[model samples]
Target chain A: MTDRLPHPLRSDALDNRERILDAARALFATEGLNVPMREIARHAGVGPATLYRRFPTKQMLATEAFADEMRACHVLVEEGLAEPDPWRGFCLVIEKTCELHARSRGFTEAFMSTFPEAMDFAAERAYALRSIAELANRAKDAGHLRPDFVLDDLILMLMANRGIHTISKTARVAASRRFAALVIQAFRASPQHSPLPPVARLSPAAPGKVM
Target chain B: MTDRLPHPLRSDALDNRERILDAARALFATEGLNVPMREIARHAGVGPATLYRRFPTKQMLATEAFADEMRACHVLVEEGLAEPDPWRGFCLVIEKTCELHARSRGFTEAFMSTFPEAMDFAAERAYALRSIAELANRAKDAGHLRPDFVLDDLILMLMANRGIHTISKTARVAASRRFAALVIQAFRASPQHSPLPPVARLSPAAPGKVM
Candidate 1:
């Protein structure tokens, strides 16, 4: 078939597309969505015309860049749902989600920001929230989750988790782990005396300190 | 005695200084510390020369702008220290501090950012930490706070609280209150199920929805 033909031009176009995406993801992850298109093109070693030809708008580039993370986010929700124990599943989802966000500042911003044009992104977010809400109801029925817990509480937790910043990605994740433990404890139906994860060295007093 | 003399020029300079500080505080609270010097002057109804004469640099302006908040912060710590119950004291400090920071985004940024020339700010911060550490120790001794609770956990909570964004100052404060309650529950040595403050409507799903 023509579609399966080994065409040199098509292969090169595919390679350029991949390179541009890679650069966009890296820059956005580090410097956030404000990084200019020209900088992304330079980083990808592609011409301005080629970059524009592939992704005409910054929003398009951002939506494409975060596509993988969004998919991973859905998989996380699925994994939680697959768990037999609803409470444990909920905790797992919170822990994993916080860690995922901690690894990429850009993803957190994108997830929280209202992008009117990104319908798919919004729909995916709504789907994930619904799944979590269902899981929460199960946990509440089992009397393992706090009765007062609301779906908006999860949003509050995510927003709070987004505030964590450290000198290194590793440290941010560590801090997030401890934070997740605290949050899980708060959300539990009963106060279980569990040892928290080790503290991450996020003190601003000791500037330049890494975890 | 000469300092008390009511010279017209001195009174006018004092009025200008007050206006500049007020404008700086308002702008910094809403827009952050990045607002330009000329803009601040314009907001204060002062000339560029007068603003520069009053505050030679942005750092100096920021320092002066936040002086009142710094004092208020110290008062909060002192009030907490004076409370009979160490746990209650700790919780009060957390709740009030978070509310204070929530009202002003710029103050949070300034508190977290290290300014080399702002020695007073650093010293006050260190003092506040030491006082909180002393309070935590008391709480631990009294068997009220979790044994594993560290000073850094407070920092973690503050950073997380800083992440909350709402449509209005009232909503932000409400969200911070709820977040503080959650953190307090997490920090408690015993799991006592108390009702949380009413949840603030901070969901991004319903964009433009105010609390």
Candidate 2:
């Protein structure tokens, strides 16, 4: 069978497609992966049949959206790797992950869970995780991190950032910052087998006020 | 009206009631709270009429079993509070809670959702939490803990121990111990604001694994 590109869309048809995706992103932010298909069509000023014709199913649409996020994350990781300072690179991954996952409207569990092809997506996550691990190991070897520390531990902490959604936005940033600082200190002390920094002696950020 | 004690149970009636609970515990552990009452009576070696006499409805029977678990937790909290060491009291609360909740013989999502009365159990949990917080506060005042920390953060981390359950059992234990030591260091450092002791540093017990 000869493979052919999708027929070029009229300008109106192309605009409608972009509108549908924008609506889908909004609906997913509020209603998660289970939002009604009709709502997306209505928001996009298209009929239900048009949506079905274009995306075929929710999973296909979600798979495409998820792939976009993977691409965005890839850019950030590459940027982090390019940094001359390993610690800054590591910190960028920490800060950007918390910010994006916490503050954005684009990412959704619905897109993640509803896609039947999530295994392929999961493999991508695994690859991304290995890249982060590589960054941590480089930092450790450079003596910025503890030698006994494994990169997987940091990954677990990062993945657990999913729980950030449960907290308020203001608190989320503060908690992330505090947690990041603690992890960094933990990494520094690990190689020397030095004890954790005394919680009291460390400079207090502010009482009752979170960073 | 003044409350009065129930009439003394006949030996046979008491034996039959004990038998019923034992069978229910076994069934619920293996089959969940939805196990049929008829099956419960048959397994208990009791007639339908006798089972109904003791527990008129399935909810009543489930409440009894669920209440028993909650009451056991209540006692553990009380016992832990009576410990001489402040930190040990909180530690016992963590260990005991881990055992009971992890090994519970029932999953009562239905009861929790369907009945308002079922939600009253939070008071008991709050009481236990308050006791632990007091111990942490006392420990801090004694120069035994980190000064700036609050007990809720510790409780959250302790409660999140189950979150780490995805790893190996040995990993679970090591994480538990690592957190315990971390908490202790934090507790001691709170008032002193000094660095934690080297002995408080925990190495991953899981060899050849990174997480």
Report model 1's TM-score to 2 decimal places: 0.83
**Docking class of predicted structure 2:** incorrect
Most TM-score-accurate candidate: 1
Clashing pairs in 1: none
Q: Looking at candidate 1, what is the lDDT of residue B165?
A: 46
What is candidate 2's TM-score against the reference? 0.61
Model 2 regions lying over 4 Å from their true place: A1-4, A10-12, A34-48, A66-69, A83-88, A104-120, A142-144, A167-211, B1-76, B88-118, B155-211
lDDT of 1 by residue, A20-57 (tens): 99999998876667678999999999999999988888
The 0-to-1 C-alpha lDDT of every candidate, in the order given, reads 0.76, 0.54
RMSD of each: 9.3, 11.1
Best by lDDT: 1
Interface RMSD of 1: 14.5
